[model samples]
Target: MPSPRPFSRYEFLIAWRYLRARRAEGGVSTMTWISLIGIALGVAALIATLAVRAGFRAEFVDTILGANAHASVYLSATSFTNELTGEVYTQSGRIEDYTDMAARLAAVPGVIRTAPVVKGQVMATAGDRANVAEVFGVTPQDFARIPRIVDPETSVGEIDAFPDGIAIGSGIARELGVVIGDRIRLISPQGAQTAFGTTPRVNAYPVTYIFSAGRYDIDRTRIYMPLPEAQSYFNREDVADEVEVYVEDPENIAALTLPLMEAGGDRALIWTWQDSSGSFLRALDIEDDVMFVILSVLVLIATMNITSGLIMLVKNKGRDIGILRTMGLTEGAVMRVFFLCGAFTGVIGTLAGVALGVVFALNVDHVMSAVNMISGGGAWDPSVRGIYELPARLRGIDIARAVGLSLTLSFLVTIFPARRAARMNPVEALRYE
Candidate 1:
């Protein structure tokens, strides 16, 4: 018949026309709105889940670092003798090169400070209350450098201020019903050995100052005193359990581990924050993977709506397809027109979901508060949940993954409907009209 006008640029316009007509149809019921909401909810949940997980990881790590050493150089097996003593005292272990090794580690880039700390586990008793605590012996001047240990507001003198002073955990202090300057008896496992066997001996080290660390385990378990005091009690000098090293950059921790070990040689085993917090970090990673996989199915289910919408559009546009084919439009072009229509729905739904998800993730704390208020519940305690506040870690990688998955599902939904439209018989389709 007459020559048909070119339809390349007209395909987008045609796709929109068909989509709008379908939207206007009487049968386009709850299914349509359900699809949109599903996609929106799925995307929002994914974003919020990841942000919370990241926040918990960061806070937990900070708590651990605050409580423990950033890194430590432990003496594998080393001990030394007192040269000034006329009588000889030999250690079963090798002599630890603390000064030389601490100096070498302190020189490393990102290394902020290094100090020698002596530690031992002893049972401290006051009346009926006896609790086991880690006795940390440190130099007063050097201990002041520790952030949590030295508070200018509370602490007046250096760590050495209390020659026989010990800082106990808050829980421990409460358990014994004692405060600063209370006398506590220290019972060490290393007691006097007689010809018969080991006899229990108790040394009473007056608790000069009791510092509360807040952690029940640590506060109750950790007792700090001067290094000299610990050395005299333990009956050993010129040696320690390990030297703690603090770094400015926690990210490049692995870089310092090997070098520190090399400087200290095989006699010392170097440990980093990662090593100390390995189990916790591993749990966080697994949590992210498990939640992503579980929530992604919601987005996939929502994509089915895109498929159904295109199928309805295909049936409605059969007459148009027949006319276009008769006008010399190829099957591939016919398929592309329908594909473009379905993709528009996918694009709009995905974009809306992303916008909403971002807003929700950002305002999660407020939303949570509102939820609590509505339910008449008290404020959430992060300590119970292992977090102090809601943390949202929104990364480019996560956003990319979400968008990519949504787009891919959208593209796939178009295939069956597009093929059906492409394969329509012109004569058969036109006969119904």
Candidate 2:
């Protein structure tokens, strides 16, 4: 008769019988269940954590790039000598040719749009409430180009009416107890230049619009006004403080920096969003690495149970091994039989974990809503978390990493016990029986 192929039906049948044996027959049925459940939970936790991390990072970056410029160009200070006094004075940098500079920067290959901005800080008051606000003076057309401001779903009021009034964040409106069409007075410390020095400038403008950028800090402290009004209020006539530049791709902003500088001329100083928020991004990267390492340890521990469970099975099936060996079963066949037992548990557990994790990530927002309803609405705090709601995003690479870690550990730990079972002496095993 021809020799049976490797992993033939007989070996599979024997392995299945061993897995299905009852406890009364010296089976490790209970340990097998424990190992399967442990692995499933470990894999699920890792997948879920990675999903949340990815989602949070994406949300954070979206908020930043959506609400603000990718980069800004400012004029460097220049030293000028007084013609008659024979003295030199350093003049504060100002973008005197801001309109021309914006058009020039807009012509760069990767540049999408450019806007001249006049920014300042002032105290805002509405009735009895008052708060400090950082104001951005942008043209109505340029303000409409901001993704977060013009998103119909999140913003209220009209962009066309912005030039006649001012736009305040929802958080600022709440703080000042004001609504659209209400007047809010702004007080600036740098006012008219008189003999006794400058006085604070105070003016009131109707709240023509309100917006929510979904970020706590931005919504709480930022206000938008017409460029003309901002220039007049801040004492900068026919000049802008800086020019905000938006690019095609913010992540690869470095490639465009030299080009933008060349276009902006000698006095231009480019500051990117990366320069301001690089440390935060670096912290997030470190956090992702640390979380993966910690969760990998959990997976390793769960897979260790597979080792223990398989060792116990080898001990319980000692008499059966003796019979099978004496019946002409090769050592390789015996090892394959035991290997299938552990492999089955790992495969099934990983599939189940993947399903559970995917379902959880896809509906994480609804889950948070349900939780908030049950817990009386304190589940998420935007001020503390920097996001209005919890986010979870599933990525293929993350899932693959989790699956690879679990299966590698399971296969490696099964080898020792399977080899021991295969090397067993039938004479000695039957002698004990």
Candidate 3:
């Protein structure tokens, strides 16, 4: 066959031709196909895992920030002794007229809104089942300011709705076998001290709304009651346990601290959502990093096939190399041909893997659903994933990085055998044949 132009045009065609030629043409080999398959599979695995992890974290972060305040201001009193009487005295260190403090905090530049809240633990009983739940005393306006403690579809969170009823998480409802309109008794940790003695405070309220934040921990343990009722139950009326603060940018919430302290006064103790959930988010970051490393190793192992495939081609085509040398083909040209041979596998495999991975990540939820159906009912654990839905996120930057790694490994593997071809002794190579 006439040699095509030996530079860019000809070299690429020659390499591609070898990739597409049939086994009968002494071009395609089993190892070549294996190498392609290996690289493609590795790239796809990496992409799919990354997308899923990203999706899960985004969902987790959104859920957390929505349900919890960006920051909170808490006020409590510590008793001090009276110097003259030598008697212990309870001084007012608490934020007085907290409603005024909330308004002032709201005016701070970064502050988005503020709501007074009373948070406490209560034993909740629904029929025969009982669970300890975190109770929040909030107004309908407060619920609106916070993330949906109940599903919006439940219609229990309207500004005017649930006037005389409590909103509980769907997970708690399921656990207690309770539903909307069910009468549940809440026993507060605080008590009313009277002639009878200090006793646990108890009240019964009808469940008017059920909510799901897609967080198992919250769904199983969080419930909401009106602020006035909470104060009455805890016996701290005209007062609040804390002021929940929402800010414009929660990622930089530390910036709001000085302003908030100025508004809420020196006695205010502040906590941010990040402080509460930092460990969980950090754990997720570590997992993502580890996964990238593990999957990249898989690609490395896959590229190993290229090294063996190139070595095999050199051995099988020794006579061909000799004939090419006789025809005045330079050592450099020979090396280019072999190098292109490996590049064909790596580039083609990387592209194919990227396509496959993107498609798979986008449809991962469907794939998971199909698997669940095939495996029988309830194959997925709701407790582990919060709801039954799969989360998937894809980023262009991440995809590009993964593809780059695959191609780099693929192109590098061909160098060794290509060098050997460039240094081939044509006379000896033909002598054996």
Candidate 4:
């Protein structure tokens, strides 16, 4: 058997000549340019869309971790399950000695900070309206260290100034028609076991602060109060519901979890942010995957254009191929000649698309702003997304995938036409001449 010869420059020269052929000389037609542009646009659009999805996912992760800790140490004694609701009542983790355990956990290698908290559900009422919300009891100082508790519009303020002060989300403030310095009633469903056993236990607190957490659900349903005051109100004096833990590096939170569990003891239940936000993040992942498949269909359609152009080229160049075959060029070389013509378009288009996509992705926020300005519309409305600007980020892996898929499709589409051109009988191809 003979080894295959090295690729000859003659093959590339023929391919280039065929691509640049004028209509008079049976060269490339207008359709070739159209197909090339179609592929370029499709690739560019896919890259931009993927970048935006990636950026949004990152933003969401940061937002969630900003308000919540990396991990939490729950001190629950026992948990109950409601068969009907499928809700497990873990009923806040209680620690007998929060201070000692928190201090110990703080000294852990990866742990950055520890905060003890009390959590429950309570009804808040001011004026004639009342709404049920999640109440968190945390010291103002510790709460401030939790990343996003303070924004330009709001702050926890000084709870020490007013021992009985209350801090609520901005949405709660609107719903209850209350403001800072106004009194709102807090009703706990866990009533004291008295003569009227398990009625609602109610108390009034002055609103001292308002926080806007940038999440529609959390901003509307969250309430914050002093930890000591909450302990007294809930009859859990000197005890905390659980200890929330923050780590030095959120990406490597697992390093702190095992040590936290050891410090928290065998009975303690520790949960990470992943556990709490698992379903939500998974849904986002699924959406990204769906978008990728849908966008890739555009490239598929563009490849069809390549197929059409190559088929036309084969029909027009039948005589040329016959002559080339007669000149001692193998059938394989004939096929390669046509394949390179189509592959050239694919390669150039893919490169151009990559450059276009990266530029668009990096400047997506700016582009949106420009569009909004020109249209005189609030396209980047913060109220709609709780974000001032649309997000976008480029990843090398995404570009590689897009380019690979484009080139693969381009290469495959040419085989049918290239093979058809190669298989023509030299006699029949030249018989009419």
Candidate 5:
């Protein structure tokens, strides 16, 4: 007779029979179930954690690049001579030819646009409520280009009339008890210079637009005004503090540093977004690595259940193995049978975990809402977390990694037990019976 093929039908049949045996008949059904559940839970946790990490990072970066400049060009300090006293003194940096500077910066390759901005801090008052706000003086056209402010889904009110009025963040509007068409007063410490000294400049502008940048601090404090109005209120006259540069690709902004410098001349001092947020990004990367290591250990601990379950199955089936070996089964056939049993449990558990993880990631927003409702609506604090809502984004590579880790562990732990069953002495196994 021809020798049976490797992992023949009989091996699978015997493996299934052993797996389906009743618990009362020395079966390891309970242990198998425990192992399966452990592996499933572990894999699910890994997938969910990775998805959330990815989503959080993406959301953070999006808000930064969408609402703010990818880079800024500031003029360096220059020596100025007093016309009356004839004394030379150093003056603070200010871009006098900002319009021309913006035009030149916009012409650089990979640059999308450049806007001259005058920034200042002022106290905003609407009725009895008052709060400190950071004001940005930008042209109506430049303000319209901001992704977050221009997105109709997240912003409300008319932006075409932005030059006629001012735009305020939703959080600021709420705190000051103001709405669209309401007027808010802005008080600047640096006002018109008089013979004696300077007086505070106070001006009121109607709110024409309300926007949410998806960041708590930004939404609570940022205000945008017409460029001319801002210059007048901030005492900047025809000068701008800096020129904000928007590029096609923010990630590779360093590559354009030389070109941008050449465009802005020797007095240009460029500051990229990375200079402000690189530390936070590095912290996030470190956290991701640590989290993966911790979750990997959890997965390993869960896979240990497989080892215990298989060892128990080997011991319980000693008598059966003796009979099968004596009847004509080879050692390799016995090993293959037990190996199939372990492999089946792992494959099924991993598949179930993947399904569970994907579903959870897809519906993370709904899950958070429900959780917040149950906890009386303070579960996620944007002020503390830097984001309004929790995010989850699933990647194919992350899922594949989780599944691979689980299945590899499951298969590896099954080997020793399967080998033990195969090497059992037929005479010794039947001696006890």
Candidate 6:
């Protein structure tokens, strides 16, 4: 007689035999196909959702970090500058290397570029329309370094065409009914005495460029101007609201923060995006947790189907389990056979789902656009929705998570069935009609 083969090799053969028998016994019936389809749909949904979430997170972060500085330096709260009315004085001991600071920051291992920013809140009015806006003064040269800050379609000459003029957000421009080259009035929050008691001090600044920051709050409220013009217009001599620093590695923020603060001396205070946008970051984390919990319901339901299918397989293959056991198969071998069947079911289901999901995620934009075209419209327009295209980003983290979760659930589904197969009584199983 030939030497007995290991169970691992025979497991596949046993699984195949059981599967063929299942096919013959109407195991792949409408109900079974429905279960498989359910699993596939669940997996596909999970993949697509995660991909879109990742894309949104990435796009928002990139846009924010690109336009805004990675880290910031501002005078302490009480030490805030009121340079417009000449009420604030610049200290001789202020950050000395304003330009050099940017160069040196760029030289740091992870640092990208450091740029100057001036901030103030003021009312922007044009004709009969008036709205409050936040002014962000930036150097044109430095602003160019931040991608997407300038519209790609707009030429460089068009951007700096008018010296001493400022860039306004698209929404703000719309609100004020102004376009590029239109003169807009800015009223500083600092009050001025008038017949109607004290009112905000106001000035007029011309708009040089129109921009869409892609963030509703920023786009609606933020404005940008040349650093020199801002400094002179605000009457701020040798003072800035903050210095924005960009870095290559966001994770090394804390490590660089200490050194940067030390280098900034006494007058400057450093804050990372994490600190500056703490609430937003926290909200993102909460959103992630909520999404995971909600999406995981699909996975859990699919796992239930896997469990049911395995249980049914065990019941139907009781005779096979007995025959295999009688033919000198170990209890572990018998168990492994059922385990393979269940695992294969899960693997096939998951793989199919992943493939479908990849296709869906990649083409979600086209699919959504087609659907939108067919349906006519929604309550909110695309611009109001924050993005025109449905975005999806496939990340290794998402893939690993999906694979790990699906495999773990699949293995779990087989546990009970495997145990039942292992404990099968040969005599009773064979006697069953």
The candidate scoring highest on TM-score is: 2
Give a tens-digit lDDT track for model 2, residues 305-337.
Answer: 888889989988899999989999989999999
- Residue pairs that clash (backbone atoms under 3 angstroms), model 4: 21-27, 75-93, 75-94, 76-93, 93-241
- Encode model 5's per-residue lDDT on 1-433: one tens digit a residue: 7779889999999998887758575448877887778888888889999999999999999999999999999988989899999999997788999989999999999999999999999999999999999999999999999997778898889878898999999899999999999999999999988997999989999999999999888899999999999988898999999999999999999999989989998888899999899899999999988998898888788778777878888888899999999999999999999998888888888888888888889999999999999999989999999889999999999999999998998888888899999999999999968
Off by over 4 Å in 4: 1-13, 20-30, 78-93, 151-164, 177-183, 191-194, 198-208, 251-256, 326-333, 359-390
The residue ranges of model 2 lying beyond 4 angstroms of the native Cα positions read 1-3, 25-27, 82-85, 370-376
Please, what are the lDDT tens digits per residue for candidate 6 over residues 266-326? 5568888778666866786788778867767777778677667767777877887788778
TM-score comparison, 1 vs 4, better candidate: 4
Compose the digit string of candidate 3's lDDT tens values, residues 233-310: 877678888888999899899888878877887677788888888888899999999999999999999999998888
Alpha-carbon lDDT of model 1: 0.74
Q: State residue 148's C-alpha deviation in candidate 1, in Å.
A: 5.8
Worst 10 residues of 5 by lDDT: 18-27
* RMSD to native, candidate 2: 1.7
* CA-only RMSD, every prediction: 5.7, 1.7, 2.9, 5.9, 2.2, 4.9
Evaluate model 5: give its TM-score. 0.94
Off by over 4 Å in 3: 1-7, 21-28, 90-94, 154-159, 377-379, 385-388
lDDT of 5: 0.91
lDDT of each: 0.74, 0.91, 0.84, 0.82, 0.91, 0.72
- For candidate 1, write residues 1-433 as lDDT tens digits: 6533434677788777766654456343344455567777777777777767776676667656666678988766545667787555544442356677778879877888888778777888998899887888787766666665555453333355566466666667778887767778888877677898776657776666555333345555788878887776665577776788888777678888888887776666888888867876998899889999888888899988877877777777788899999988888889889888877777777787888878877887898889789988656663355444566777767777888888788789889999999999999999968
* Model 1 residue 140 CA deviation in Å: 4.0
For model 6, what is the error of residue 292's alpha carbon versus the real structure, in angstroms, after optimal superposition?
Answer: 3.3
The reply for model 6, stretches above 4 Å from the true place, is 1-3, 7-10, 20-24, 27-31, 77-110, 153-157, 162-164, 191-202, 327-330, 370-390
